[model samples]
Target: MKELKHLNKYFKKYWFKLLIGVLITIIARIFSLIMPSYVNKSIQAVEEFMADTISLSEAKGMLLQYILVIVGAALLSALFTFLMRQTIINVSRYIEYDLKNEVFDHYQLLSLNFYKKNRIGDLMNRISEDINQVRMYAGPAIMYGIQTLTLFVCLVPLMFIKAPTLAAYTLLPLPILSVLIYQISKVIHKRSTKVQEFLSTLSTFTQESFSGISVIKAYGIEPRINAELRVLANQGKDTSMSLAKVNAWFFPLMILLIGISNIFVVYIGGRQYINGDIESIGVIAEFILYVNMLTWPVAIVGWLTSIIQTAEASQKRINEFLKAEPSIKNEVLQPTVIHGDIEFKNVTFTYEDTDITALKDISFKVKAGQTVAILGKTGSGKSTILDLVARLYDVTSGEVLIDGVPVQKLNLNSLRNSIGAVPQDAFLFSDTIENNIRFGNENASHDEIVAVAKKAVVHKNIEGFAKKYDTILGERGITLSGGQKQRVSIARALLKNPQIYLFDDCLSAVDTETEEEILNNLKKVSESKTTLIVSHRVSSAKNADKIIVLDNGKIIQEGSHQELNAVDGYYKELYLNQLSGKE
Candidate 1:
């Protein structure tokens, strides 16, 4: 229940409608109560007229009045019921809309690490299933629960006023029934939580299998994957069946108790009639009507219990996501603009759960508009450096500064927007090629995009397509070849025209001839921009103003190509290896 406190804002917004709904429901219940009394009074009127207790004309008038009262009550009851439904339905919709929008806004505020840890399916469940469950509580469950309570409380007093003994007999089983409902509700809450968890697992499996269908097919393991899916499906089915079994037993037990109470009422009321304590058959008939009305309210207890428990479970899951704090957060007061000059001063970093440092007390500086090349083997922290510079993750020790100001003192959005990055595995959305390029600069003109594409050496390949720039790329750019995708990604980064450009092995997919052409273009474009290129190939790094060699997360050598070739170290070994392979 504490977890659901966040929903109070939505409740406050729709409280007027909710109040109207409850008021209409109460009016409807009161009008409905009048019908049984009118029926009883009309019966008594006829009996008295037959016994010569009233004049014939007077009896006729009395019967006519009772009939009109009954009809009017029925009409009022119908009208109030309609009003109740209309108001509550609107409240439910508004609350659902508000909750969903809040969830979406929260998602936007979350850091990248949150997405990396949580699955897309689980997040979808929070926005969809969890929100719908809350709607159930706001809509039918809330309206019905309030109506039932009012009906019981209002009618019970009326019963006592009409005939105290009959009222006592009818309500005899209520306390015991209430205790039973409370106990069953606890069990339902626990079981329903388990059911929701199983459903989340099933959704996760389905989303993963569908998203990775290409990988599954390429591995030729569809049968194995199908078997795993079957297992998850069976688990979900078993959980649902178990919940059904609980519901099956719960409802019948409640009905049985209500039935026993009804039997007791008939037995006790019949004896009172025989003893001449009760007046006419009309009073006993009205008592039966009241008992029938009481049955419906008791029946809804089981349903309301289920709705409340499911709402609580959903609230808990949603709150867990909302409470998660990002590892990299903006400082209390951060700078807005960052100069291109960057210095890494003995920075050391390791991941949260690992002892092995990814970057070991490294130190380097790149002047504003200089091109620096990082030559390293795999797992040599090339990507980690880019991640740190972008502030995707903070350093464990030392400092990384931009324009002599610590990066931690800079605003995250302003800093990140000033740099362009092309990672190792470049990804493009399933959208038009023009749109993909425009992701780098949303307001970039068509001419600018074309210019950058030509510089990346992919414009000719794109023009070969039927739709050219308008052609829709497949998911992750599956429609394009590896080299084409790499070039398109490079063009997107170039469109941004940022102060810094970070290329992490972006040319690995293109052939040496194409790579050389792209490098020549980059040399001209990178003249006044700070550029850092991470490459495994010796040919790519040979022409840089400075080359830094890294191995096992440490810089082993640094100098010009000619200066490094003069030394007998890792750089010379790498150069000799490349020459030998080419021969």
Candidate 2:
């Protein structure tokens, strides 16, 4: 119930549609209630004619009028029901559209650490399936719940006026049903949450398996993965069946309770007529019909209850994320293009919930339009340095500044847009080569894309393809070789024409000769931009204006290639090892 409060905005936003739907539903119920009275009248008219208390012609006219009223009521009920569905269901769809958009927008605002903490499939489930569950509550469950309430309001009073004793006897058992349903609701909500969680797990397993299908095939571990999937599939099925059992039992129990009420109506109403307390059999028959009207809505309570329980579970899950505030806030004095004089001052960063610091008092400065290279062992905080500059993760202590403005104070969009970074993984979308290259700058001309590709040394490879630049790559550019993917990624960054460039070991995939060629090409473009290159090979950083050596999350050495070669240290050792390997 508390979780449902999150939907207040949507309710207020589309109140008109909700109001119209409710009004139509009430009208439809009124029309439906009216038909049963005509049923009573038609029965009495037949009784009067058979008793010869009324003339046949008069009786025929009355019966014909009753039939017309019945027909009219049925038609009006159907029309309003259609109108109610049109308004309410469409409003639910609109709400869904808005909610999904909001969630996606929040995802964009969230930092890289948030994504690192949450799985892709779980987020996808929230956007797709969980939101859909909430949709049921917004639309069909709400509509039918209103219809049931209207029936209860309008029909209950009519029953009491017609025969108070009959109403009392039949309706008294209803409180017990409500109590029973209230108790069952707790179990239903619990099981529904379990089902949703298991479904998320199933989705995650499927998504991960597909994403890593190549690895599975290469290792010939398809059988093992399939077996694991079966376990998850079975768990999902078992949980669903558990929920289905609750539904199966709860609905029939509602029908059984309603059936008992009907029995009470027939038995008690029959005796009241026989005792001459009631004047006519039609009264009893009318009460019976009114009770029948209550049956479907009452029986459907179980189903509606199930929908509500599922929605509550889903809303809780979604609201938890919606309520989360992104740790990184985009703040700015004034939005401006960065000149990219980056400085990390006494920076120390520990990831969420970990005592181990990834970066410890790391300090460095890169002048505007200068090339700085970083060499480090694996897990020596080389990539962490790049991530900090982009504000993907904030520093635990000290500050990262760009052109005298703290990165945190700069507008996130302005800060990120000014820098071009090519990560080690070289992720690319499943799109044409030209489109992938133009990802950083969609307005880039075909000529510009080809030029960048040539500069990255991937243009010749693209030209060799059957569709050339138009050729669509596989997911994450799987169709491209490792070197080709890296080069394409480099081309993407080049097209941005950013003020700063960060290359995180992006040339590791290419041969030494090709890497040198691309580096030389990059050197020309980076001459007017601040550039930071993280690399393992001394050859990669040898030509840089300055090279910084890192060890255990701290800078151990900082100097030019000539000075570092003269010093007896990690840099000199790394250079000798690479030189020896080449020989």
lDDT of each residue in 336-420, candidate 2, tens digit only: 7799899999999888855668788988899999999999999888998999998888889999999987898888889889999
* Least well predicted 10-residue stretch by lDDT in candidate 2: 174-183
- Top-TM-score structure, candidate number: 2
What is the Cα-based lDDT of residue 364 in candidate 1?
A: 93
User: What do the candidate models score in CA lDDT, each in turn?
Assistant: 0.86, 0.89
Q: Write the per-residue lDDT of candidate 1 for residues 1-583, one digit (tens) a residue.
A: 7877888888888888888898998998889999889888988998899899999999999999999999999999999999988998779888889888878888877776678778888898888888888888879888899889998789899989977887887888766676677677777778778877776777888888887888999999999998998888888888888777777776677677777777866777788878877777688788888887887687677668778778978988988887877777777355487669989999998876455688899999999998888988888888888889888888999899888888888887888889999988989999999999999999999999999999999999999999999999987898999899999999999999999999989999998889999999998998998888999988888888889888888998988899999999988899999989978
TM-score of each: 0.88, 0.93
Candidate 1 runs further than 4 Å off = 42-79, 82-86, 101-120, 264-267, 270-280, 332-335, 445-448, 460-475, 579-583
Could you tell me how far off, in angstroms, the CA of residue 374 lies in candidate 2 after the best superposition? Answer: 1.0
